[model samples]
Target chain A: MKSRKTTAWIALCASTLLAGPALAESHGMALSGDLRIISDMSNPAPRAVMEGMVADFGEMHPDLNIELTIVDREAWKTQIRNALGANPPDVVNWYAANRMLPYVNAGLFADVSDLWEEPAFEALASTKGAMTINDAQWGVPYTYYQWGIYYRKDIFDELGLSEPTTWEEEKANCQAILDSGRKCYTIGTKFLWTAGGWFDYINSRTNGYDFHMQLARGEIPWTDDRVRQTFANWRELIDMGAFIDDHQTYSWQEALPFMVNGEAASYLMGNFAVAAMRDGGLTDDQLDFYQFPKIAEVDYAEDAPTDTFHIASGAQNMDAAKEFLRFVVSTENQTKINAGDALGQLPVNANAEIGDDKFLQQGFDMLSNNASGGIMQFFDRDFPAEMASFGMEGLQEFMVFPDNLDDILARLEDARQRIYK
Target chain B: MFPTPIEKRSRAAQLSYQSLLPLALILWLLPLLAVANFSIKPESDFVNGNYWGLPSSFDLFANYGRVFFESNMPRYLLNSLLITIPTVIGAVALSAMAGFALGVYRFKGNLLIFFMFIAGNFVPFQILMVPVRDLTIDMNLYDTKTGLILFHIAFQTGFCTLFMRNFIRALPFPLIEAARVEGVAEWKIFWYVVLPLMKPALAALAVLIFTFIWNDYFWAVVLTQGPDAQPVTAGITEFNSQFRAAYHLMSAGSIVAALPPVAMFFLMQKHFIAGLTLGAVK
Candidate 1:
């Protein structure tokens, strides 16, 4: 099967090479020397996708020796700095938004703002804002997944509740679900980042995208009235006993059973949870999704964290690296890589067709059209790492003990002051 | 004194002891038993929170099949063997010679030289993590099987030397003297006379070091990165994907990774036990 795919790809490549002289010239110029790529897509499926892309690109330009090293995804988080600081690769995998702040400030990541100016990159405008820092683009997004409420449709149907839209309706639905002797939501704060999702959604929905980005950039203090308002709104649900009890003890996957067993009606999670939910035996009719309900009169600012690729500033093959970045974000490659059997996420290219999954369609539509406010890269990616760590601990504390709002806010305020400086 | 045997206790006490012994055993082995159970469970069982329950369906072949056929596990296991066998042979060979010299000879600073070998064992191996990694990179040995093998031998030789030296010291001094009287050269004495007497100690130390090197996770992770060099201990984590931990696959992979050391322990049970008690009794 793999040989057949390679043969077909080779035939197509030959045809394209023969048919387009302009394309051949462009490829020839960028195909010499070597392009060293270090990817963190080390899972079996994504690893295959990365290798397949490299192989195809290598085939297109036989002279370009493509060296690909796939580091384990979690380990890459720490090893990236060392890998970049020393003998750096031409291209590397990273995330979009403030997560790139350190590398950008250190001048380790090369600015790819010129690529964004090209007409081909206009297809990837949805995530352009996320890739921008200091009014220049640093990388290009390859894939992203939306964060929202994945609820037990059967439980909601049995209880005769519709998906809530406004904050009042969301509270009403939670109250109804609570009355039915089931928790309204299942969340695990043991690892603490899960609580960051709650904060991003509530905080973004309360004060719009700009204010939330300001808070993420440490421009607004954690003790601000708007930040407190976001918590006060969240406190209503906590006081109503809406979340599963003893949630602090469970990891995110551990919290899945509450919804799977019908003890909880909903989970605020990313699109990846659908696979696990289906594995736990929820059919399409039994499961559903909805954007987090509006709290105040702000535009919907969804959390769609994008995974991206950036060229090293110390790259030896800058032209090849730039061309490879273009290859990664191209409509054809984006669609193929993010297909249902591949990444199973939304492709960033606007012209690219998404996978035929129910949630993917919703997420693609939501991010491309409905999210007029802006895209958030989730809290952990949006905030500086130190502040995010301390901020998540504070968020988890607030969820458990809402009365310690002042103390948590003060601590986060201190962390923000120290971290941002 | 040790507690009285259950057989010697009163009838009621004996009955209670018999009943509680199995319970205590199960309680102690619960984590292992759970891992065993998890290895055969379908992935959905974990998702459904059926952690302690019987598997909904038997997936033993499916899970282990993926680990063996579809993953880098076989290569990792092969790396483990390549790493372990060489380290065991290298460390044992070097230490055996050092032991013979320290045990049989009266060289200058002999006690001090032995103390240096013993002191190497005292420094916590964790503290060596950074410097050892830097050393490997400096030697251009990082992420190679040779690097891991060399480090394992270097680190493990310290403990193995102490064991071999003491075991050699306990051998009769008359043996070497007898070999000398027979006009045997010194190297010949080590090979023909002393090495023959150290057979049990060699077997015991080889078994001990084999398990140590096979189960070494910390240095394996710090020194190596991918399947080309990483042993099964570090490579077992490859079962975890970016977003989800494949608990079933990981459990199966772990069982496979653990098999070599477990098999060694069982097959070399006598030597293993002797390795534990050899120096202590002396």
Candidate 2:
């Protein structure tokens, strides 16, 4: 009876050990507990690409599970702020520079410099400048997309219009298009950020690259004459009826069909819009690209600004996140992503090959030729997000009520002071 | 006879008002009608600017299928159900008990506690963000549906209690007195006598809670993360990002996400209004 009782106890102990591991497995791989990623990219193609990438990552690292949640741009900012104040995601998609600075200062992101030095990241070192703060690398660089004008080739040909090489010629071409009874520019400012593309290019053109940077850094006053000139040029375009009417009510996506259907001449957009334009049914033969017209200046460089990705400082699996970042910037993955519907994006790595898409290849050639004089980050990314918010609102007010430029400039100056302080 | 009887004119006016009712309803539902139309349209239709016109092709099923199959929409729906149903039941139950205590029993601080609940319901969620999240994290409930449900129940209990107490206070006190005189125990009086009479309140609160919780986006994002716990509203956002320019899919997804609450409202319109307007008349 003693032996039987002992045997029964031994069996119970063995079963309990077996059951614990089973329960863990049933709940699935949850290395570092639970992991989540949030981003503002909600379109299907990018989502499918990300989902596929995550699935592949899951297979390779069975002990780690990734959850991806997406929110609209407005909701994304609000949710991220709330989540950070509450329970932050393990990994998140956010902008680099001043955007990450506040979060890093708050001890929200993990430092991953050790992973940055790994062999897989050697090619990304060139782009890591944007992601680093106080000499510490905070996030991984996933995708770097370029910005340019995507024009309707068919409409340009029909109107006998060639890509303008200078700002004056670009305006003249727009005037001609308007003279011919076609909408000179098909743009939307419902979200207001769409108008910033115009401001970034014009400021980059008029003040040159370095001044644009200084402007973003708040070293220059908003009421400075050079700054006023940028708005003056924008006002000129508006007075010329270069922009579509009811722009305040239309989102970029909503205004896309007009460009696709040949009702409008051009869309000032980023490389990401290539996918959107194609999805709107424009074929390769029907699309063409050009740099935003350069203001005639001795100091200006030709390169447009860039968008970058960074690792969160608070990421639990910093090593894994770095590995993923390396994979993204690798020539193999960059080529694959560029070859897909998205175009005009240049891989940050010098050695990475351009994809088969002609527009993307041209973009690569432009990058290689150092045709880009100097890179300025996009306006929204370059400025403090809160200041950018007010700036965009100011742009809307300026657009809707053009007579209030002085008021707009004063309000912007006030916002800039508040943010910089 | 020459002046026309008052009853005859009243009858004509009533007939005219009834005839105009369907027309008014149609006018009110025009926006919804447009959305429903857009929900069924093929991608090509939207691209071709056929927004206000009849759909060139019907791809409703295809769009909805993509939303479910391509995204983790099934998981999202289940998560929403898990969070919302439990929140409704939990909030209603707790509020009912507290409301009874406050409404029937004349005790010190009764009005004070009641007013506190009323004022607390109006406080901005930002004030509660840090503490509530820290509490949930310490409880080891972060990122779980239970975490979301718990916060929702606690937060909603304020509004629900106020609603319930006011509702119960308006009830006849003679019913409770008669039950007590019949030698019924307090617990039994609540269970057998009062609860049955609270059916309308129960139904009304259930529908209101269902809609509120289902439509909640801010808390869904803050309290939950993975597909395992995120609700449909948050899921719709993820879906929107994934399919950036795919408006057809987005429209269909919106309709799918909105259906449950819409259906609940339609089925229980009378009870919903009765519950909402309970004290308004008084």
Against the true structure, whose lDDT is highest?
1
Question: In lDDT terms, how accurate is model 2?
Answer: 0.73
Q: Which predicted model would earn the best DockQ?
A: 1
RMSD values, in order shown:
4.8, 9.4
Model 1's number of clashes is 0
Per-residue alpha-carbon lDDT of candidate 2 for residues A1-421, written as tens digits (9 for 90 to 100):
9656544543343233223223333223223334576665545555555666666556544666678776554556656666665566656666665567777788777776765666556655544656777898877655565667889888888888899978889989998889878787888799898888788878878887677767887889999999999889888888998888888998887888778777788988866677777766789889988877778473434333433444555566554454455445555666556455542356766566776776776665554454444654566777887888899889887887899999999999998888888
Write candidate 1's Cα lDDT for A160-210 as tens digits. 999999999999999999999999999989999999999999999999999
- State the fraction of real interface contacts model 1 keeps: 0.66
Give per-residue CA lDDT, model 1, range B1-282, as digits (tens).
379877788999998888999999999999989999999999999888899999999999999999999999999999999999999999999999998888878989999999999999999999998999899999999999999999998888888889889988988888888878999999999988889878878988888899899999999999998888999999998888667889999999988888888888789888767766855797
- The alpha-carbon lDDT assigned to residue B157 of candidate 1 equals 87
Residue B195: error of model 1 in Å?
1.4
Model 2, position B198, has a per-residue lDDT of 79
DockQ of each: 0.69, 0.19
Candidate 2 CAPRI assessment class = incorrect
lDDT of 2 at B36: 83
